[model samples]
Target: MSDNVTFDAIVLKELNKPLELVKGIQFPDLKKGQVLVKIYYAGLCHSQVMEARGHRGQDPYLPHMLGHEGTGEVVAVGEGVTKVAPGDHVIMTWIKGSGHEAGGCCYAGPSGETINSGGVTTFGEYAVASENRLVKKPEGIPFDLGVLLGCALPTGAGIVLNDIKPEKGATLAVVGLGGIGISALLAATTFDPERLIAVDIEQSKLDLAKEFGATHTFHAAHDDWEAEILALTDGKGVDHAVEATGLAEMIERAFNVIRPGGGELVFASHPKAGDVIRLDPFELIKGKQIRGSWGGSSKPDRDFEILADLFRQGRLPLRQLLSDTYTLETINEALEDLENRKIIRALIKISEPPADAA
Candidate 1:
């Protein structure tokens, strides 16, 4: 790869419009402790869709780059870069800290609005990430699987083992069976939850959720959804409910479906400010609690390795969750597929970047 190379990137010039191919943006030169990654796979995430639609209430810097889950091989390194070599496969995570220690959530550039300040962390053919922010992929883990540990897997697993921590033989309900909902279902199985109830508007997604480990499924968009969830739990309500849809009505219902002393975990981040959900205060008095989680409260250095081992053993279904792939030039099409629920996950493949020139 040459130092003077440039690559085509899908860029959002304005909120609420289709993306366009933009060329001639120079890949950032590596700085100290930074490595230049030749991105091979970038996961299309809901956050990117939210940002493009202006659903992100926070003021996102305009002309923003859009992507967070990315994986590739290091093609170049700056002075003192040591964690990865030129050919080592790597996954880029949102966790950023100085030196080798993971720090509180901080991003390095103009596109960091999805996670923090400093915009433009990802969404390019090549990205400059700190050496510490990357975890080397095991010999056989493909780039697509590796990218997930950075966010989705940990968030879903954390909701089960950390937030809900469903006790043995407990009954659990997962609302919004999207990417994260499906993952929560699998994680809940590790605890041997007596009944894993999955709820989603689309029956196809619910059917897919059942294949992934959901013990029961319900149509949330139906008028009698609350009654159906209660009936599934045998009228006692579930011991745990996870709200992954990030909608206030869904969040409220998660509370309603939990047993008197059960717990609720809210994993999705809402876009609008002050979106309100009504819930009875008496439930709090009775020990029903709703908690918020970030990145599954994960330390990537440790949690990522654990997830990798699971992926290696096939205990965690990585590839099964993916539905489609596209080139950056077809990002709009990819997003449309996602919006229509045509795919569970869509990944963008960047191919044949120009060689760096002197």
Candidate 2:
């Protein structure tokens, strides 16, 4: 296997600080079941913000690399790799897919120290990902939009399609209008939900949700927001409620507004380490089901194809969900926009896609 390639990357040297933009990071030799990729675009999710802020608890792996969703082209493959090949366009994701789940990679930092990374990290010009963490990018999909398929699309869309599987004409509400929540709204539209109500604090997000096919939109900041949702369902409450915000209050509110019997709640957010949610036992006893979603229990190998087909047919509206794009030099700005709720979804252009990628 050839070696001696170096690239620029963003490293989290400490908690609650701007990531260190280090150049000339040396790539270690390919380990078994690894694939080297030339990254094109990556998506910034709220989970990375929590990790950067030290909200996810102890940081045993300080000075590590970050980011989990990206679109790239395979540059090389390690031993025992069979799922993808050189020059193949792929989505790099944290969700393990069809191939081998290789261990994390170690990149040599400029100061001669080892920078630890997970099985997949994408905020860089190049990345080494486990074979199972990649799925082939379908023809005719833009690489930029393909980044969303890596995480938000699967997690949000999957929650409705795979986990909840709400019946046609069912009433549904999606709280939080970020990428994941908006993706859920898009997916819910396809189910022919009788009422797809969107809840968010931002009018901009609600407007965007309506454009993406929400039957109604409500501002969550309203004191009677929950009541309004219940009113929409004729005082019974929605048959399904999906909460994508990691906030405990929102999670509780989502659970409280579901119909008593056979109502389903799926919280897709990754809550902070010390955060706990409280639900009344009476509600549980009444068959008000509640559960957390792990990437919407997605099977990337199969689901990616379905989502890509939807995008191609213009049903998914993947492009409308993107709010802004920034290059690696302005990644901190991207993170701030995400934290401030200024953007629906932030895309980081780590490197230009190959000329023929389109």
Candidate 3:
């Protein structure tokens, strides 16, 4: 528990290439509004994949850390910190919260190189995070399950519960069954949509969506999937649509499924760089609104508690969220699994959990 901590981490030294695991990297001393955390469980997201593959464009921050969501124990706190203290279990998130904004950190690499880090990076054994990026983990939620609260739940559930705010018995459809898609589908069921539709290329995910309260399911593998949805809605469209896949065409398709009058579309997915989504200008005339969601426009300090309560009450089926688990050494495998669509969410275990927590 000293300022000179050495740990292993996944660093993106080159874009569109496998991340490098640099061991014995020296962590810098915590600055004002900073907190040092021993990372336990982290979630692998498509955002990291976007950063690693240079899909989001530009790589001025190469050899930097990757990961914006995870769970960890606060080992120490820096000056002017008040939100959380040392030894308090907390959730690591990219969503800014109520605390100081200590900027990114600089670490001394093994070979005299420097590794840049953001206010919150979780793909390592330890993290030096900004105090505003940390939120107290509710005791009712285990560390493994709490990891989802960092990004997936906030963005996924936040979209339906916060932005769209569909009325009871309304119609809704969630396209794509990845972490965010599945989370949106799970949250949409709470509203009791008259026709809660789920769409995905994989039958397994479609079947799983049904178990989580989707009234109807569609396979996007078919060319006429959108037409089928329109048919199901009697030539109309759902009141709201959530596009969770980061494909430009899918976002446009999701927008098309929205009803003309006062229909809304919210997408949480991020398409690759230079990917443009073209929409018919006439849709706007029809009262069809579309907007991109930045972490579901979530306020983590207030939302995490509400989300945690839902999880405790069994309303959120988060126990089954993670599709697979991997160690830090197998980080590449985790990313590959995510890219291949083999898993909904991959849990990266930087350090082993305690006996009871496991």
Candidate 4:
């Protein structure tokens, strides 16, 4: 493929509006530290939904590409690129890794205007990504399943293994059983927690959480849901409470369910702008700590391999997290399913895999 090669992409032409499936977009010439990748599968995450709804802030980059988690094959590498070569299957992620970090790309739009894209954008048939944003996919892993390693797995599982580090036999609760929440719940099971409580408003999510090793499941809509968790923990509370729902009220509630002494709450959600989480200062005085997680503070170069190994061993129930799959043409429908909480995780098939490749 050449710099003038035309491809298709889903663009955010307007805020709080449906994405525009624009075709015949020209790929920009690869700059230093950039790699051209043929995107195969992309994961639909809440972050994209938030951005599309203008929940986080103003839209400085209208007509920008959206998506940070995906699986692709390196079609070309630019100058100074060494971490990966052409034909190397890779995981496209927003997080930085080992390689040269290049700036965003500019593509020729269908209407002769320029389309803005970040270092890593996967809701398209092809992407020009920073070298540091791509990690070589593990051998023999299904490309569709490998897409989670780009974001959900690293953030969710990384929180359990790297951030919270719950001790064996400890009690833990995961609020909001979304993709990230369930990933955390799955990771917690490896620690042999005495009780793993899954909390969610939807019963379907709660049922799925049980299949992911949740020892106890509670519907957050119930008036006594917190009480149920408290009772499970002998009225003290869990040692660690993970808040993955980007809602302010859920964040506060997650903080309230932590044990009085030396308890910790780690939130991975990106709440809407001006949505403040009000917590009692008194809780901090009692050694209750609350902190936001940035992709589970993960080092993808090291953690993605570990997660892949877990998946190979059949220890990580990743397939169960995949609720649905859609084509790039139906990207809006996929996003709607996600926003409506009708799926755990939706995979967008951007392009077909090569005949020789898996």
Candidate 5:
């Protein structure tokens, strides 16, 4: 196979520091179960922020790459790969799909040092990810919006559609209106929930959630969100709650906000290490349920098709969900905007979409 591809990528050289946009990073030969992707667009999520700010604990891979969800085209595939072929439009995700699950790939840094990368990283113009890290982009899905399927949809919507399976007229609330929370909120609406409440510290996010079919919106900056949510449920509580912030307190809050006797809370947050959540033993005894999700327990091959159909039917308002866009060079700024709650989901434009893709 041809082996001459050098590209630019952002590198996290130190924890709690800005990432460097190193140029002309050379690529090595693809290994077994690896797929070389010419990235077009990538989505920014809080997990990247946690890594950059040292929120997710000590980083052994300090000089590693960042980002997990992106949309691109397959440039080449390693041996034993059967999932996708060259020129196939695909969504790169951290969630594993049906393919060979390779370990990490090593890239030649600008200074000739080996830079570590996980199964997938999209903060670059091109990415070398495992075969299982991608799914064929379904027809009718735009290149940019594919980022949602990579992480947000599978995690957020997966919690409701795959895990919770809330019945029609079921009362539900989603706290922390990031990409994942909004995706869950959008999916929850299809169930015809009695109360689809959206909670976030930002009024802008809450406002957008309202437009996306949230029956009620709550501002989390105040101290009364739990009380207000309880009042909305008439002191009973919601049938289900999905928390996405990954904060320990918020996870605990979502747990407390649900009603007893089968109230369910599925949180997708990965809070800082050493952070402990204190919960009352009585809640568990009262039949309240809580479960942590691993990518919403999704099997990408099946779930992405369903979500893409939702978007095709004009049910998933992805245009509104894609809050803003930034270039690869400004990826740090994009991540900062997400951390500050300035945007819901930030899109990183790595390269222009193929003209024929339109």
Candidate 6:
């Protein structure tokens, strides 16, 4: 093993600030039941941007590393470990402290202690993971794909497939067609829907949504969205609406466009802290549901492999969902693409050694 090896990592040096490349992080002495993973790929998710913008939290604490979607091989393990061994490829799912589930406020509450305790500190070269935290990467699945399964796909698909479970041939709508929204669209493809509508502020994303399985694509900023969605459903309203943008207004709109007894899935984390959304009680009384999905309510160890198999069989076309790729050093540019809606699915490429291992 290479002792005292150092590597560069993008870090959040201040709250509401830009990320900077830094070096010289000391590898922690592995404690019992912990494993050290040499990160090969890390996705720059919107949540990380929230953290950088001080939306996840405020300063002093703001300076900590901020990456949750991590995939790599275990290089070392501490005493009493058994889930995975050194050299085993794995995906890191974010669930801090302790929690039985990954998505939803209830599941997220228990994780507060963990996130508060230390897991928020992982956007570095080598990340410390619990034995159960790492899910084995499937054969032939690229590291980029592995990291996405940990959160993006599961969260997106999990919301529709796991949480909302829209009825077969039911009309559906998804707002904010970014990573999560795109995954939701892909997930919609598996289950035949009467109508699948994709909504985003950008026309480029709306265009991409069609490729992901959307039957109709519309700009959320346009005045005709509600009318258009209703018109598509024959004015009956959709059976389910998924809010993936994390904006309060969009979530409220999702509630409005769904029919009585329809389901709404909130998948995005809000851009600002303490942002409140207003809703009417009559809507809920009519059997309308508003729910938050965490990592798509994914049980990674069990569901990820199932999803991987689907990907391999061509049931889920993950390749089409990916629109851009970036190297670790060029992370900001990748994120800029995300901000500009130039790309729907973006993966940060970890410059790897030759395909044949040493």
Error of 5 at 35 (Å): 1.0
User: Listing every candidate in turn, what is its Cα RMSD in Å to the true structure after a full C-alpha superposition?
Assistant: 4.9, 1.2, 1.3, 1.2, 1.3, 5.5
lDDT tens per residue, model 4, 198-261: 9998899999889878888888887577878888778898999999988999999989889998
Candidate 3 global CA lDDT score: 0.90
Q: Cα deviation in Å at residue 197, candidate 2?
A: 0.6
Alpha carbon lDDT at 221, candidate 6: 77
Shift in Å, residue 157, candidate 2: 0.3
Query: What TM-score would each prediction reach against the true structure?
Result: 0.87, 0.98, 0.98, 0.98, 0.97, 0.88
Segments of candidate 4 deviating more than 4 angstroms: 355-358
The lDDT of each candidate is 0.71, 0.90, 0.90, 0.90, 0.90, 0.70
- List model 2 lDDT by residue over 1-358, tens digit each: 2354578989888999997788989888898999999999999999889988888998998789999999998989999999999989999998888889898999898878999999999999898999999999988888999999889999999999999999999999999989899999899999999999999999999999888889888898875778988888888999999999889989999998899989989989878899999889999999899999999889999999899898888899888888889988898898889999999889998877877775
Give residue 118's lDDT in candidate 2 (0 to 100): 94
Off by over 4 Å in 1: 1-4, 58-60, 96-120, 352-358
What is the Cα root-mean-square deviation between model 5 and the actual structure?
1.3
**TM-score of model 4 vs. true structure:** 0.98
* Per-residue error (Å), model 4, residue 281: 0.3
**What's the true lDDT of residue 20 in model 1?**
66
- The per-prediction tally of clashing pairs is 9, 0, 0, 0, 1, 6
Error of model 1, residue 1, in angstroms: 7.3
Query: Cα lDDT of model 5 overall?
Result: 0.90
Q: After superposition, how far is residue 96 of candidate 4 from its true place, in Å?
A: 1.0
Error of 2 at 27 (Å): 1.2
